[model samples]
Each structure stands twice: as C-alpha cells, then as structure tokens.
Target: MNIFAKTGGNMTNRRDFLTGSAGLAGILFCGCGLPRAAHAAAAAPHRLPVTVAGKHVKTIDVHSHCLFHEANALMGDEAAKLTPPINGAQQAFMTVEDRARAMDAMAVDMEILSVNPFWYGKERDLAAKIVSINNDKLAALVASKPDRFGAFASLTLQDPALAVTELETAMKKQGLGGAAIGDQVAGSEFSDPKFDPVWAKAEELGAVLFIHPEGVPELNKRWAGNGWLLNTIGNPLATTIALNHLIFQGTLDKFPNLKVLAAHGGGYLASYAPRDDHACFVAPSACDPNIKLKKQPTEYLNQLHFDALVFTPEALRHLVAQVGASQIMLGSDCPYPWELHPVDAIMATDSLSDAQKHAILGGNAAKLFGLKGVG
Candidate 1:
C-alpha cells in the first residue's frame, strides 16, 4: 500500500498536491555549487580547473563521503559493515590533507561530506550520541579547512523526534548545509508518517536532505558473487523505490518545499521518471484507489534535486533532459572512484551550453546551500 492509505486520510486540496508541469520520459541532451572550497585548491601543488567554455566554475561534489573513527567506535562490531569489501576504508578516514588532495585530483573544488549511515539500527540514546559525535567532528573538519569543505549533518533517524532536533542543531549551530540519510530508516521507509516532523522541520529550516542508499540486503542472495551487485544494482534500486514512495505517498505533497538531493544521479528514476505517470492508469488493481498522486508522477521531478554521477556524457545529458539543469550538481562519489572524472563528463556533454554547464558545476548547489562569494 502507498503511504496515503496507511495514513488513512483523504488527499489535500488539489492545489496543494499539484505543482510543476509534466516531463517527457525521454528528451534532448543538455547540461546542467558551493564552498568551503576555494583557497585550499589555490595552495595545492597540482590542481585541476573545472571550467565551462574556458571560464572557471566551482565544482561541488554533493555525493562525496566520509566516516568518523569515534562515531564508528560506538557501533563496535557493527562498524565493520560500513567498510565495503573494497579498499575505501582509508579514504573514509582520510586526513584533511588527503581528502583535499583527492578532491583536487577529481577536479572537484568543494566536497560536501556525509557518512553513509551506520546508526539506523542503534537505540535512541546510542543513535543520538553517534550523531552528535559525527556532527561535532564534521563541524571541526569544516572549520579546519573552511575553504575546502562543507557537510551534511549526520542524523539519528531511528528516532524521528531526535532527528528534528539534531537537524536544527546542525543547521542552526554547527553550520552544516544539509542532512544526509540512507534510503530507509531501520524498518521504515521515509514515506512513513513517523517522519513527518523531521520533514516539517527540514522544510522550515530550508535544509537540504541528501538521500544516499545502503543497498538492499533483503536481496543478498540474488546479488551473491562477483561485481558487488548489491551496490551496483541494489543501491540505485533502493533509491528508486524510496523516491517513488515519497512521490506517491503525498509526503512531497505535504511538504512541498523540502529540498531533497538524491544521490547516485537520483538512481534509476531520473532515467524513467515519466514512465511512472502511466502506472496507476494501467494497473487499477495494483495501485490503491484511495491513494493518488497530486501532480503527474513526472511532475515531481521538478521538486527533486540530483547528482551528476551517472558516469557517461550521454547519461548526464539524459538526466539533465529529464530533471532540468537547475536541479543537478556535480558528484564524484569520491573516496571511491565510481566517477573517476566528474568534471570531464559535463565538459563532454556536447549538447550542454556553457550556462547549463556552469549551473550544473556549482551555481545551483551554491544557491541551494546558501553559499555566497564562492568562485
């Protein structure tokens, strides 16, 4: 059942749920923020300039990641789960200089750091403690190199009430630009009404909600052996599912202004968004009659934001076509090399104009994060 049914409430006024125009499932190529990300790069021994049409632009990597030693310590044995079989652990715990060097190499001028969640299963007290440690360390890191970093605060989502407070503290006090989250919270999807207060507060504070994925463990057997299918396939799949739930559940309707930035190029949804509009019409039995989306399914794309980590020029071009240049920003998934050349992808999108390229590189993110005076 979609969340609307579970909540047992009728849809709001048509004007409330409906916003934005419909998007075609397929479209033309095109293009598409931030700082604590300037001076440190100028001091680097070797640097890469991310420019569009020979003009420099700030390249903000919104999907970048990090993890903390003290916070992970709280997880004890469970901390091991945060480290994938890959050799990314070193980068996750990278020293400030090392992270700066990595960003320079990736041609990313600024990185908005986030910890892939390990606190979702912890109890309220433990989760709050872990989140507090993570937020404090993240604040310190940004302070240590204010020109090279920004962060999305770690939140204790298992306890929604605490998450609201943590978000407020992080944004209002710690100076975090946003909150990063996994696709699901313990056993609940974000569409569950239990998360309304967090969404409400995020909307009120204008916080950016960056949704990363933790893979689909329920399908572990299907992903067994070779190629890390769980991450390669499951991660995007999980994001796709979470986004759809939010779209159809009227969560987006209820909190229309919440700034949501979906990682991994907003997963598979960016590729097939317009396709979702046809489902309820085609399968009357599968979809709940009582639950209906306010806007056309594809229209929700306008309210959402995405990263440019789809890994190919045409894919990047296609995502821009699907979601619009205003909604995208650079992302390297750095610290691991899913996107070995983020800047090059946009530079190579032959269809993108310089303006589109500049906006995607950093302008959009800078505006969203409330960063001013950035290059």
Candidate 2:
C-alpha cells in the first residue's frame, strides 16, 4: 500500500501524514504515455519501515554525528580550514522536525549522535571549553526529542582527568548515554597508562565508549593517490592500531568490563582478527615478556561491540561470524553516505536469522545503552 493512498497518492511528507495531503492526482499523460501519477509515485520520498518479519523494530544507529556552531566559535582561526560537507552534512545541523524527517527517510527510529574529535589535539583549557559546549548542546538536543535521539558525549581526551570529569558529567548530569572518543589522543596510544583513569571511570560508570577514528595523518605521503585514501584506509587503520595496542598492551585486560563500541565495524581488525591472535607467536620480539595477557588477542573482541557499517552483505555476515551477532549493531555514519541503506544491508543478509537480524537492527544497542520502552 502506498502510505499516502488515502490522500489520492499526493501526500509526500510527514506533514501530510500528520494532517492530510489534500490535492487530487492529475490525469495528464507524458510524451511516453505514462500518467502523471507514475512520476509522483516514483518521486515520492523513500522510507523503509523499521520492521522485520512483520514485527516493528526500533532501529537505533549507534554511530551518527552532529556539529555545533558554538563549538565552531571556540575554534577561532582553526575554523577557517573547515569546508561544507560535500556529502549529506545538513543532517549534522539536526533541527528537530527536519531531523525526524531525515531519520524517517533513513529508516532510523533513533540516532546516537557523536562529535568527531577535531578538538583532540588542542591544549587542555581550550579543549575543555570546546567539549563542554558540544556536550551541553548535545544534551539540549536530546532533551528536546528524547525518544527519537540519544548521544555520546564529546570528551577532551587530550587531558585524561578532564576527560574523566567530562564523561562523568555528561552521563550523570546531562543524561548523555556515553562518551565518543578518537582512536588515539594526539599521537598517544590509548594503552598509555595516562588514560587508565578515564577508562577506569567509564568501566565504573558502565558508560559505553564509542571510538570513532580521525584520519591517519602520518600516512599523508603514501596515501597521496585518489579514492580519498586518507579516510578509506587511514580511518580504519587508525582503529586497527588502537585496538591492537589495547589488546597486545593489556588495556582490554585491565578494563575487562568496559563497554567499548568501535565504529567502521571495529575497523579492519574484526574482519581478520585471528591474525591478531597469531602475531605474538609469529614474532617473539613484539610480545611483552613481563606483561602476559590472560586470553588470546582475538577473544577480547567478545567483550567489545561494533557497528554494522561494513558495506556488503558478505562483509556484514563475516563480521558477525568473527564477532558474533550479539556484538553487532546498526551504524550509519549518517548525514554522510558511508552506508546509506543501513537497514537494507541488515535485511539483505541471508546468513542472519530473523532473531539475529532483530538484535542487530536495534536490540543490541537498546540493551547496551539501557534504552527503555522501544518497539
């Protein structure tokens, strides 16, 4: 059924769904002899009902983003380098009714928004201000539409103590769900002992830490060719290095209970994670003699969570096989075209059972974030 059939097939937006689409269809035919109704039907905005196997699903995208002008104000001269997004950046602006319409178009019932860590390299006082504005603004946005949206707090990871306090305040004071952090703080690996306090606080608070990657700046020379290799290769590689350090250097062991969600399907690590298990055996020098890990490197993935933005059905299926269905949740780098049809990708995977599909669509995120009263 055309959802707008009651309106003579003229209704095109949420406004029509709310009140009604009043216009009647035209009888005129095009040069091809097709009725005007055919064009209208074809041009109607796309919507994927958040449902599976005849049951309504509450689809939550664990990976989405937003930006703030207030934070941009803090950038001063650095703001000059910013460019309008060629992809769908308007989604980041997120006015309530407009965002709701956008979410409907994407089949997303809720979006857990994060700010990319552009401020991570800043000094403490400045970084703190930027993060504070972003977190406060994000809280206000969520308050306006609590059911339709959730958010991961921005943190000043450059300063661990401040980051801990920001995480604490965002979760407890402002009612944020968790914190979104970069894969590394400046050039420092997360496994550096200085970050332990922040990770420990997250573990204690049961806050999910969403690790989104900033592009690999160190590879600028080698990635000079086309295809935006900086992001396509660097972002995932950055995540891979971060997770690898966490695994090999014992951060995961130390913070076993931390609910860490990695964007880009845990990057490339989850795709062939068994290679991580063998790295120590293949090269003795890389393994730390004094600090022995309790489990093989790959087993740590069981404790981590990942977004289902791996692109192809085969990739999604393989990611699940590697990490288990429970670990996978929907992730669309929305307002961006990374994975435009996130729900369709889940629906298209023949390898996943309906129950698994249900979990991946929203159940896992709802469970992880302690979301309530969702369909």
Candidate 3:
C-alpha cells in the first residue's frame, strides 16, 4: 500500500489518501526521496522544519527560563518578587514542566535555563534568598534530567562578594553551564568601578554571563499604561545602555576574557553603532580614556555573542553579516508568546551557506555549552 514503492507498483487508493494530508505527505515525500535541504518547504505554518546540519543534529537552546515554586512560597504577598505571580501574562506561560515538554516536542537536545531579572530586582537580602532558591531549583531540575536540561545560575549583583561565592557553587559545584547577569546591577552599569571584582571572578572561572535587560528602577514609570509598551522599547534600550557603557568605558577591553552574551539580538548595537562613531567625530574626547582602541564601538559588539532571536530573515542575515556565524547561536525565547521559529527563519535566509547554517543552529552552541560528540 506504500505510495512511494517502485514505479511498476499499482496506484492504489492508499497512495491517493496519503498525498492529501500535508503533514503526512511531507514526511513521506521527504523521507522517501527529496534532498535534505528541500525539507523546509513542506513545513506546517507554526512548526520549524528545516534541514538539520548533520545527522540527528542535537539543537541546544541557549536561552530559556524557569520559576521556582518554593521561592514564591517564601516571599509574602506584599513583596515585589518577579516569580510566578509576576503579571497575568508571565504567569500564563512560565512553567518548568511545560517548558521541558516544549523542548522535547521541538527536538531540542538541551535547554540552558535562566531566571528573569524581574525576580531579583535590587534588594540584596531578598536577592540573596532568591538566588539560593532559584539555584537550588535549577540544580535539581538539571540533575533530575541531566541529558535534557542544563542551566545558568542567577547571581545577586547587589552583592559582588556573594555573587563570587554563588558563581563558584553554580558553575563548579552544581555543574551549571554558566551564570546569568542583567544589564545593570541596581542602577550601577557594568563599567562602574564597583563591578571589576565581579568581572574578575567570572573571567577566572570562564563563566558565560547571559545579559538580559532590567531597566533602571526609576524609569519603569516613564512608560505609562499601554500594556507593556515599555517592554518593547525599554528592554532594547537597557541592552543598548549596557553595551555602550561597556565599550565607551573600557569594560570589554579590561575584562577581555569575560564570555558576555547580549539578548534580543544584541539590542541596537549592530544597527546604530555607525552613527555613534559619527557623533563622536565632533569631539575626540567622546572616546573613553580607559579604552586605548583603534577600532570603532561596533568591533567590540562583534566580539560578543548574540542569540538568533531577531525574528526575521533580513535581520538574521544582517546579524550574521555583522557578527561572524561563529558568534551567533540559536535562541527561541520559548513560551514568551513573541517567540519566533528559529529553524524556519534560518532556512528562509538565502545569505548563509550550509556551514554558516550549521554553526547558527547547533555548532556554535555545542561549543559554547561544551556539548560533546558534536565536535
């Protein structure tokens, strides 16, 4: 009854039936005869069906989140903790078990988990408790399913000394992938002299710091009542602020070994940096005294890592063209509602070669996460 049998086989009704359903037809046709790269053309509207770089290509999602039920139980209702009760919207999508299933459904080999910065805020004491609880939960989750999950620990940047201690435990003791840090630690930017010690510890441990946007505590009110309009502009601006401070103040040059990663496709760093240099043309002093670099601000941006969450074929191509494929990796931002289909987006792009696609999908992340056997 197989429709794909030799040409001499009878054209049975079963052959006609299989060809009608798009999903089944795609699987049968691709599985039987088409070239690997052509598989994406048959994808369903919401699904990601692209050519995997290699056989059984194990995709590693470098960006994802988890919430600790225990942490919420500890804080009283009045506290502004960014856990389960964060907002009706966040609560709707954030579930560890559900996230795991989604990863499995998407054929993700592993997910590098993190806690959002909203949960930690700026309270040192509360941040400490949140860190312990979150780290405990992450460790247990990864340990429970070692093959399917890995995590990056969140540190209380409010206390650098405590952050150092936490990094050792998270990266060395618990076998986490690395650490997650925000754009600013309680309004103090990365270039502030106070952060040198934290960066030093990260450099020594070779930790990967996933930088997310947590806008200044004072600025949240500036965007009033439009259903998280601030999130769109605010998040990207926070990242931009962090990158500018890091570059203009010489944080990147000083802490060359820090494996810092920027979220939301590296914010505005890739697109707007040329104008930055043009503005600096009026004053030579616009460049920081700390940095002795001959290169422009965009050069440092290229040196950092970016996740492929830009959400467009054009944006993806520009990202790759700006930063080499080696610096880009897959990031679905899963369960975020705004999540884009990374595999399909990558496949849709005509600018990248097969080798570049491989790096963006799996190869770069495999190396970053120390994923074995893929090397």
Candidate 4:
C-alpha cells in the first residue's frame, strides 16, 4: 500500500504538505481552532502534537541552527579588524516567537539548536569569550522554552585545552546537551591527536558532538562561480573529509563511546562506506593495518547519528539501508530553507515502515538528547 494511502487520506506528498495544501492546516491545527502562530505561542516551547496516519508523532529537528545576536555583534567587530570589511546589514536574527511559528509551519515539535562556526580563527582569549557568550545565550534560550529547544554548546577547538574546560562548563554548569563543532579547526583536522582530550571528555560526559560544516576554505576558488557550489558541494565535502579522517585515523576506535552526529546525512561517507571496507580487505597496502580498528569501518556507522536532509526519498532510503533507521534522525536544516518540507519528505517515503518513520522523525533524537514526553 502507498505510504500516503496509509496516512488515512490526510497527507499525500512532501510538496503538498509543505505548501499547506491537502488538509494540511487541519492536520496542523486539529485540536486547536486558533491560527498556527497563536497556537504555537500558547504551546510556548513545547511542540504541538501532530498526527500522521492517525498516529501522533512528535517531530524533533536535530539539524536546525540559530545565531545569537549579541555573540554575532562581538564576533562581527573582531572579524572586521582581521579581514576586509564587507558592509551590509546583518540578516535579521529570528526571534524565539518567529522560530516557533516557523516550526509550526514545518510541523516540527522540537529543535536541537546549533550555531555555525564563526570564532574558529580568533585568538584564545577572544575565542573563549565568544564560546562563553554563545553557550550562555543558548542555555538561556533553551531554558526559556524547555520543551521547544535544546542546544549543542560552542567550543574553541583551535585550543583544545580551552575546549576541554569550556565543554565541562557547558555540560556541567549550563546543562547543555552537547557541543557544536566545525569540520576543522583552523588548519587542524578533528583527527589530530591534540583533540584527544576533547574527545575523551565528550565520551565521558556522553555528549553529542554535532559536526556542522565550516566550508572547505581551500576550495573557495573552485566554488566561487555560479551555482553556490561553496555550500552545495563544499559543505558536504568538508563533512566527508572530517568523518573520513576520524574513521581512517581510528578516532572512533579510540573513543568508541563518543556520540557524534553528522549533519547532511553523514555527508557522502555513509552512502559510499562500502568502498572503505573493500579498500581495507581487497587492497591491504592501501589500508593501514597499524591503525587497528576492532571492527569493520562500516560498523562504526551504527555508532553515529545522521540527520535526514538528503531531500529525496531514494536518497533517504539508501542512507537507511547503509546506516539503519535508528541512526537516522529528522533534520531540516531549519530556518535556512534548505529543507522547506522535512516532515513530508520522511512521510512520503514508500520504502519506510511507520515504525521507521517514527524513529527518524523524533524517537531517535529524543533518546539522543534525553527529551521527555516524545515516546
């Protein structure tokens, strides 16, 4: 039977659900007669219930981002002194109410907020200050809407010692769920030995390290032309490189308990992981026996989490086949418009069972972030 047909004739395809057609407003506003915005305000930080196929599911978006206005101002001034000033008003920061309404439109129940890396190149003291400010703001925001938002703390990985201290403070004092990090720190890849302390700390704390892309600066010239390749290709390419380093260098082996969540569906690595296995078995010379992993490279994929932002049913299905449903979580890359219809994307997949869809939508993330009332 078609997945849409199983949904009791309420939703059909991703496009329709996103466009707010085909009884979408009714589905979104089922119990409440109020407008979506007003309903969201009444719910405040908690996700309003959404029913799919007569089953209520709480949608958690693990890949959404936010930019704290105060942190941006401080960093913006410092950035100006270091580089050529590009003049323009900053993109208006979305307020909490604005974000809540947007979430309602997307049918998302909760968001695990993270900020894109901006202080990776700052001096140690300056970077520490920025990390403090970002984490504090994120903590307060999540606290204000406990049901609606959770956050990954920011870290200054360029100085791993400071990163360790900051991570401790964020997790212990601020009660942040995890830390958000870029693919690389300055010129240092995450696989560098200098980061072992940070990794060890995360493993101990059981924190989820969200690896968002900072863009591959070396490829700027190639991505400069039309088509936005810098983001289209560069972003995933950066994540792919970072994960590869961690895999091949045995970072996952060293810290097996490290809970890492890769954005953009684990980039290109998850889909192409079999190649690593083949290279290790078929081409021994190409593989380093000295690295010494306890299991096959692909097996480590089960140990990690990925956001379902692949944008197509086929791609999402392939990722599940590669990683498994439990490892895949809903991630819209929210507020960026990269995925205007995330819930519909998963709901429309003919290949997934209702159980699988439920897990990807919110169950897995609820477990990962320790969210309540999602079961």
TM-score list, all predictions: 0.85, 0.85, 0.80, 0.83
Superposed on all Cα atoms, the candidates' RMSDs to the truth, in angstroms, are: 13.0, 10.5, 13.8, 12.6
Runs of candidate 3 with Cα error greater than 4 angstroms are 1-42, 45-54, 78-97, 119-122, 216-222, 225-227, 285-290
TM-score pick, better of 1 and 4: 1
Q: Using lDDT as the measure, what is the rank order of every candidate, best first?
A: 2, 1, 4, 3
- Candidate 2 stretches with Cα past 4 Å from truth are 1-49, 82-85, 88-94
**Which tens-of-lDDT digit does each residue in 45-91 have in candidate 4?**
32357555678888988988765444555676564332211121133
lDDT tens per residue, model 2, 247-330: 889999999999999999988998788888788789989778987999988999989999998887899989999889999999
Q: Tens digits of per-residue lDDT for model 3 on 118-234?
A: 544547888787777667656655665566677888788778888888888787766677888888876678899887888898888888889888755567787677656467778
Q: What is the lDDT of residue 310 in candidate 2?
A: 87
Write model 1 residue lDDT over 82-106, tens digit each, in one string. Answer: 6676543433443455566667776
Minimal lDDT window, size 10, model 1: 23-32
Q: What total of clashing residue pairs does each candidate reach?
A: 6, 0, 0, 1
User: Higher TM-score: candidate 3 or 4?
Assistant: 4
Model 4 quality (TM-score): 0.83
lDDT of 4 at 66: 64
